[model samples]
Target: MSKISAYILFLSLFLLAACDSAKKEFETLKEGEILLDINTEEYSLNGTVLGKTATDISVIDDVIDKPLYKELCDTRGKFLEEALGNGESIDIFELAKLHVDDNLSYVDFYKALSSMYFCGYSDFNIAIGTNYKDVFQLSIPRTDYMWCGLVIQRMKGLRYKYLRNRQKLSLSEMSEIDVEDRECVEEYKGLDLLLSFYRKDDGIAYVVSLNETFFNKGSRFDGYNFYTFNNDADLWKFIEDIRSKVDRQIGNMPGKKEDKVLRLLANAHGPNKVMLVFQKDVLMKDIAPIVKKLNTYGYRFAFDLD
Candidate 1:
């Protein structure tokens, strides 16, 4: 074919393909759904028809809006007193220390922690340790980004739960928003679960690849541990095995070393960190349960924010 004719043919094919793509996108969008084409890399969007796109977004640490904070305190004031001293004035962390066990159950302590976290005290921290109160100091270690990130995500969840009820958005509309829950904060039982299972010197990070059919487990970034789980039961079993080994190791340690190990485990950068590798297409509904389970073990979750 002549050059001019070949160029014209290529243009026609390009237009045809573009039209086909547009048709597919249009078909997937429902009547009430609006399509957005965003180029900035600061926002991540998850939707059924639009597909999923993740970006390098920092967790928003904005204090809960005053009106909503007031609403929360008003309705849950009695519950709030469990953590906040006198239900109003006092350093919350100091107050938490006083009731570390006297008045607070593990569950209740976490509830108070969540209240304080959402109430603008983002410095509060937790970790896998014997004394949970020791980890609740105002000076959270700078290395504990995973724990901080989890709280931020939990706050995001709470904001959605509270505000959505007020806006009265339809179920269909609500589904589009990725509302990770506040449960991870309140439901965390790291101290109760005895999750200090790794040797303090080992420095192992459990990075799990959440696949479609199974989970790929890795102890180091160098390679996978060759352990794949087709079910949650197997994953729990593997963790138990690690715990058993840790117990044996601790039994053999000198008393001084054992004490040192305990102190090390309480630090935020300790062995209780897990990096969950998720495919972009994975839904938050599927991710939430696993996250909650991990939180129960006092496992701080890290993600590929990049």
Candidate 2:
């Protein structure tokens, strides 16, 4: 081959490779608003990329085949707009009372929402786990009028150290309970508040049903303990089943011993999705049944192994 021709061919290949790398790292998405038609191995969904990081992108838009404004959002669409519009400033700590105007299209509502808070985005369509045998179909919804959940599991059993010259909590403990978990289970100032967030100007919101909150509180010792899913019998059953399998595996381990209580923290997400942080090592198969069940029910999962 002639030197000139060979050099041209090598440059073409390099450009192509660089383009592909940019797509994977989402560098291409940062150029402008990108309309992505995604079919990830886990699920299929569409979104518009509004922002990007070195490894991830922000979904400022959701694309769906049908209108889910009514079935998806428990409130009237107009109410949602009023909550955000009204020409009034938003207090991220307010009760989020419903009050306002009569109409706003689904697209406009979401546009306003994304402008006010980042709660409106989903993590694109990443699979629950990296590798698994089962394949569950995907039915991604337009969450314009709806909310999605984020589960942050922390299993570092907590304790109440009464006194010893007004001892303060370590930074790690504070981070786990306050910052990492989004203050879901918090002792703010002095009040024990089992707070559930729906909108945030500087933080994130994870929806929690009123019934679920009452149930979690009922299961606690003094409205401040994290216990099993007492009200969610079916969910608890699935969790216990997974726990049984993982427990047996731990039993077979040579010299490992229990350190603290087995903690699983899942902030109630919009979909039935959850994020699990574990006390012991767990294989994909160990939790396959529930994971598959959730997938079957149109749910997704993300885990924190650290």
Candidate 3:
């Protein structure tokens, strides 16, 4: 084939591929359904979906309930006893202190629990609490009692500040728009750790803003990112990959720092409708483990090239 003919053929293929990519199907879920229901018997514990649509997913078990807490406490105490040896002076308070002092990453903390069977493969539950006293809260318990509460407290305050600042920006932008002859009041909706809503004078609903910690570095409280969509099935599939890798690494001992970082980035950006920009070369391999792990969680993994 002539050079021009070959070039035309390649271009046609590329355009067809692009058109195919643009077409995506969305699935809706009703409330109280298990967004990522994993049958422990059929699936590996390491594999679990991270995201669930509010309408479709059901609650498998509330790991935060009192009974679960008690079980965890008893198991953790036993592990500590063995680690410290028989009759070595140790208390829960002291153990908590050590966890805080070390500033251990999630990987290290998970390893500590798994080593003693105090904890097993589990997805880190990320909850957004109601606004109270003008503060937003995001709470995820520490597998280790000593530092988990403190860490959560600090994270809640930081998340509040980040969301509040972003809201201010959104409101300011709305105000600058011309509304000389139109209604000018801003209707504020409830706020949460993950999302805030607002209605403008023009009757357009706006998503106030998501927490900034997911994208910003040097924000001491930076950990994971939360993405929202009209549909959550695809997002959850991606999340399962991350959860699987995290669980597998912790089980193996000596979890890698890179894994944690990549998981954070993917969790924060993967579900967004917009394109994500990052230091690709630096985060490339770090992201691979997460993608590989997602398969165990039962998600058909695919990249959003668009």
Best by lDDT: 1
Tens-digit lDDT track for model 2 on 211-241?
Answer: 1222232332122222223233544464445
lDDT of 2: 0.31
lDDT per residue (tens digit) for residues 1-306 in model 1: 999999999999997787666445432532212222212222111121222112111121322223323433443344345446545543433221111222122222233334444543334233221222223223323234575466534332322222211322222232345324333333322311211111124332222221111111232111112243445677687766654544544354456855777645543453455544433233333444555566565665443211
Q: Model 3 segments beyond 4 Å from truth?
A: 1-64, 86-306
In order, candidate lDDTs are 0.35, 0.31, 0.30
Ranking by TM-score: 1, 2, 3
Residues 39-116, candidate 3: write the lDDT tens digits.
211211112332321211122222132332344455445656675776554433222200101121222222222322
Mark the regions of model 1 whose C-alpha exceeds 4 Å error after superposition.
Answer: 1-141, 144-224, 250-252, 261-268
- Higher lDDT: candidate 2 or 3? 2
The estimated TM-scores of all candidates read 0.30, 0.24, 0.21
